[model samples]
Target: MIDHSIDRDPARPDVGHGHFRVDEKRWDSTFFGRQIGSLSWTELPADRKAGRTELGRIAELSDAAGYSLVECHVGMTDFTLISLLEDIGFRVVDSRVRFLTRWTLADVPVTTPLDGAIRWAVPSDRDRIVELTHEGFTDNDKFCSRFKNPDYFSAGDTRRYFEAWIDSTAFEADAASAVLEIDNEVRGYFIYQVRGEYEELPVVKGILTAVAPNSRGANGHLAMQAFLYHRLGLSDWFLDNTTQLTNTPVIRNHIRSSKRLDEIVLTLYRRPAA
Candidate 1:
C-alpha cells in the first residue's frame, strides 16, 4: 500500500502533495454554500497504483472533512489520469478548448448598429456586465455549463457565481478590457490580461467574453470583436482564448479567423457515494 501524507497549510488541512491530494476549495465552497474540494496537481502521478490509492484516500478524507464534492480539471490528452479518475468514480462535467488566435481581433468588419461596436470597459459598466454574465451562463439548455450540474450546484448558484466573478473583474483588467455598447447600453464585454511579451509584442490572454442575450443575431458579436482588434491595434499581440467545447459560435469564429487549436481541458467531479 502506498503511504498517504498530508500537507499542513495552516488555513487548510485537506491539502497534500504526494501522488495526489484533495485541496479544499474555500472560494467555491463559499460561493455554492457548501464545502467543496479539488484534486491538486495537474501532472499525472508516476506510479499509477499510488495515484489510485491516494485518489480513494482523498475522497474518503474529503468526505470526513465535510466537503460535499471534489472537482478536477485535467488536459484531455492525459488519458492515463482520466482513466484513473474514472475508475475512482469521477464523472465528466465539462470540456473546454483553448484556441491560439494570433489575431485576437476579428478580420471581418461585420457591421451592426454603429452604437454596437466594442469599446473599453468602464467602472460604470459593472452592473450590466454582471447581469449579462448571469443571463449568458444560466442556460444549460443546449450545452452543459460546468457549474450547472444538478448534483453539485443549485439552480441559480452558477449564474450568481459568474455574475459575482465578472463583477469582481469587470474593470480590473491587467492589460486591457473592452465593452460593446448598443444604443448607449452595454451589450457585451471582454477582458484581456497580458501574460507577458513575445519578442516585443504583448502576449494577451482573453479571460472572459460575454454578450447579452438581446444582442444576438445582428452580427454584433463579430462587430464588437473587430472593434476590439482595432482598439488594441491590429496584428500586434500574441493572443489566446478559451471557450466551452460546445460553444459553436466561438469555435466557428476562431476557425474563420485562422486561430489554431491550442489545448483541451476536461473537468471532472467526484462525491461520496450515496
Candidate 2:
C-alpha cells in the first residue's frame, strides 16, 4: 500500500499553505501514541514555539500509531529547531556534505563509455525500475524492509510511482532523468533537477540514483557522472546527496571523488510505546 501520511490535508488550511505536510496515514499507524518513524517537515516558519507545538502534536500522533523512528531535513543554518529536536532525544543520524562541480558551454566532456547503454526511459521501463530499486536498496536493511514489505508499498503501488516518474513531462524537459541498461536488461537509473537561475552558483539537485547490486562496480557512478556532464557541462556546480551515517561506503565515495564540500548533521527521532 502507498503511504499517504505526508500528503496535504484539504480540510486543514494550514497544511496546504506551508511547504510542509504531515502524513496522516502514518499518523494512524501504531506509532502514533509512543513513537514516530520517518517524519519530514519542510518550509516551516521561523517561529520556534509554534514549530515545537506542531512537532509535539505530530510526535504524539506518531506515538499512538506505534512508530519508533522519524526523520526530517532542516536548514543547516537553522539551529533553533535542530537543537530542540536533539533535546527531545533525536540523535544525529548522519552528516552529509553538499558539493558542486560546474559545467560551462565550452567545457562539456564527452560522455564516458559504459559497458551498459544509457537511454531515456519510457513507460515500458517501469517494471525494470522497480526491480532495480528493490535490489539496489536491499543492502540497507531498514530501507529495504520499509520499501519491500507489503505494509509499506505493494508492488502495484511501487509501479504506479515509477510510471508517474517515467511519464512526467517535467522530468523529460529538465533532462535530469535516465535509465542504464546492460545486455538488454535495465541496471540502474537517476533523477535530478536544476536549481537556481544564476550561472555562477547553479545547483543540480539529485532526486534519486540507484544501481542493481549485480551491476559492475562504478556503473552507478559512471552513469551519474555522464548525466551531469551532459546536462551541466564541465563547469562547477553545487550538488548534494544524503544517506544514513551507517552507509559508510556512500559517504566515503562522495569524499574520495571530491564531490562533497561540507557535511551537515541531522537527527532521527523515535519514541517506542511504553
Candidate 3:
C-alpha cells in the first residue's frame, strides 16, 4: 500500500488532492503543495479501453480538485492510454530509458586513475552531498529542460526530493551511498540499492550518481559508478538513466556502458489542470 500520510494535512475527503489509493494497487499523489497530481500504480489496467478510461477518470478528478498539473508515464505497450491522455491535455515531456544487465565484477574497466578516494558517507556530509548533487545536475540536459518548462516540471521539487534522501541517514539499509573525495574535499557521490525490491530476482540498482559543478567534463561520474559497482560486487543490476536526446556526451557514456535497453518510458505532462 502507498503511504497515506501525505493526504492527512488540510484533509479533504480522501479525493481532493493528496496521496490516495485510486484503486486497489493503483495510487496517486500530490506534490509541490498539492498543485501537481501524479498517477502511478504497481500494475496498470491491462485492457486498453479500461486503462484509458481509468486514467481519464483520474485526470478529471485532479482537474476538479484545482490541480494545475498532472503527469504520468505510460509504457510503450500502453500507447492507447498515451493517446487518450493527449486527447485531453497532456503532452510528452521526455522519455526515460531503463538499462539492465547481469553485471559482474569482471565487467569493471580499468582506465584513467580516479584521482579521488571513495569512502562511506557520514552525518556531517549530508549538506555537502545535497549541494553537490544540485550542482552536478543543474547543467544536465534533463534538469535544464525541466527548468525551462516549469509548467510541466518542478526543478525545485526535484532538488528537495534528493535533499531529503541524502540527509545523513544510515547508509546500509535498503539503500547505500558513498562519497568521492579529492584533496580532502567531497567532489562526487553515488547512491544505489543493495538489493532489488523483488527478493527472488535480487537486482542491485544504481539510482542517483553525480559530481559537483566544477568537476563536469571530467569522467568523475562514470569513475564513481565503476568504483561503487566493484566495491559492492553486484552480480546483476539495473540502472535507470535518462538524458535529453541532444545530450550526446552523457548519451554516449550510457550507450557504451549499458548491456541492454529494457524499455523507454515516455513522460507526459498536463498543464493548467485540464
Locate the minimum summed-lDDT window of 10 residues in model 3. Answer: 17-26
> What order do you get sorting by TM-score, best first?
1, 3, 2
Superposed Cα deviation of residue 249, candidate 1 (Å):
4.3
lDDT of prediction 2: 0.55
Tens-place lDDT digits, model 2, residues 27-123: 3243223233455666566777676666666656655554555555554676566766665555454444455544444544456435777776666
Cα deviation at 63, candidate 1, in Å, is 2.2
Decide which is better by lDDT, 1 or 3: 1
Could you tell me which 10 consecutive residues in candidate 1 have the lowest summed lDDT? 1-10
Regions of candidate 2 where Cα sits further than 4 Å from its true position: 1-97, 100-108, 138-175, 196-200, 218-220, 232-236, 271-273
Work out the TM-score per prediction. 0.79, 0.57, 0.70
Candidate 3 lDDT over residue span 120-147, tens digit each: 6677777787787676664354454443
Comparison by lDDT, 1 against 2, better one: 1
* Model 3 stretches with alpha carbons more than 4 Å out: 1-31, 40-58, 65-68, 109-114, 139-148, 152-158, 168-172, 195-200, 216-219, 233-248, 271-274
Q: Per-residue CA lDDT of candidate 1, range 1-274, in tens?
A: 1111223357766455466678666567666677777786756668899888877777677777776888888886676788888887899999888876554344445455444666778878888877776666666367567677787777777677667666555555454677788888888877766667765777777767777767776666656556566666546677777788888887898889678888899889888767
Per lDDT, the best of the predicted structures is 1
lDDT of each: 0.71, 0.55, 0.60
- In candidate 1 the C-alpha lDDT for residue 191 amounts to 72
